[model samples]
Target: MSVTGERLKALREARGWTQEEVARRLNVSRAAVGHWERGKNEPSYDTLIRLARLYNTSTAYLIGETDDPSPLSAAQGRKRPRSVPPAGWGRLTDRQKEYVRRVTDEMREIMVKELLDGEQ
Candidate 1:
């Protein structure tokens, strides 16, 4: 239960909404929303539910229980995780997927470093 102020602020910022906007949606005052993001106060149970719905997230995520707030958790008749890719990569073997993942990871690291260094 990582109820950090920064996490709340991050979630709010990800939606590109102002504190007043969130407040209006949650039917609360802007000051109340500000307080929640500032770690000065916590929302009530009903308010928490409202916030979760408004943010399209789980209450656990809002309180920082898990990083994945995908609505799939509550979804019924959900499909199992598929090891085989959908179409293009479906023909590849497991070893091939591993190779692809390794190469992609390496490329991602290189690109991230280059961007951080301000290089083209």
Candidate 2:
């Protein structure tokens, strides 16, 4: 595969995103991602920039000029929380957990309805 194709595949896999997921983020079809990875075609310059931004890397790194492609290199080798919880929410009792779950579900439904209605 070409350097561009190899780098694209590596970056996408590093982020644990499937081709379809990457395609959705880039507003392209999964086939386009597959083709790019397979070197059947190349993305335009604008798409290349979009890919780098989405993957949090530089365009030069995406094209395989540098091994350390991550834009977060400054924070590299530092320990960080696996998953940070929202502020103001400590560990919850069983009752509180249930209540929060219900409220979250209700809010999700309301937001989804609003979004779908707006689309129509």
Candidate 3:
């Protein structure tokens, strides 16, 4: 198998996930996962990002750039940039604002973590 394929197989096996399980998580066909593991095909950029996220590793490691499988940004200890409140957020009542902001912040953190954790 190709280096990328070998790593992909190894990572999936390490996770104790079946090919069908990986495919289900990725919203792809089991055959597609097989193709990736066999090196008959390579995942797209976006798919690679998803795989790296699911595997808790870096695309750099998946694609054979670096051997270190730790996350790219977390390993570097980069600080998250401050996020601005959403537009029209001040129109809410004080209590409403607090509740909404908390939920918004939580959702934003998930999005930011996903974007930051995966290389574009």
lDDT of 2 by residue, 1-120 (tens): 756789899889988999999999999999999998987886766687689779887654555434567652322432224265333337544644454445435534654676678789
lDDT of 1 at 68: 63
Q: Estimate each model's TM-score.
A: 0.56, 0.56, 0.63
lDDT accuracy of residue 106 in candidate 2 = 50
lDDT of each residue in 2-97, candidate 1, tens digit only: 253556677789989899888888788999888888878767656765776687766545654346666324223333234644344566558545
Strongest candidate by TM-score: 3
Q: Poorest 10 consecutive residues of model 2 by lDDT?
A: 72-81
What value does the lDDT take at residue 6 in candidate 3? Answer: 87
Better of 2 and 3 by lDDT: 3
Off by over 4 Å in 2: 72-120
Q: Model 3, 1-120: lDDT tens per residue?
A: 655688899999998999999999999999999999998987876687789889988665776545678876644753333475444546655854554445435545665887777976
Candidate 1 Cα outliers beyond 4 Å, as residue runs: 1-4, 76-120
Question: Please, what is the whole-model Cα lDDT of each candidate in the order they appear?
Answer: 0.62, 0.68, 0.73
Displacement of residue 108 (Cα, Å) in model 1 is: 40
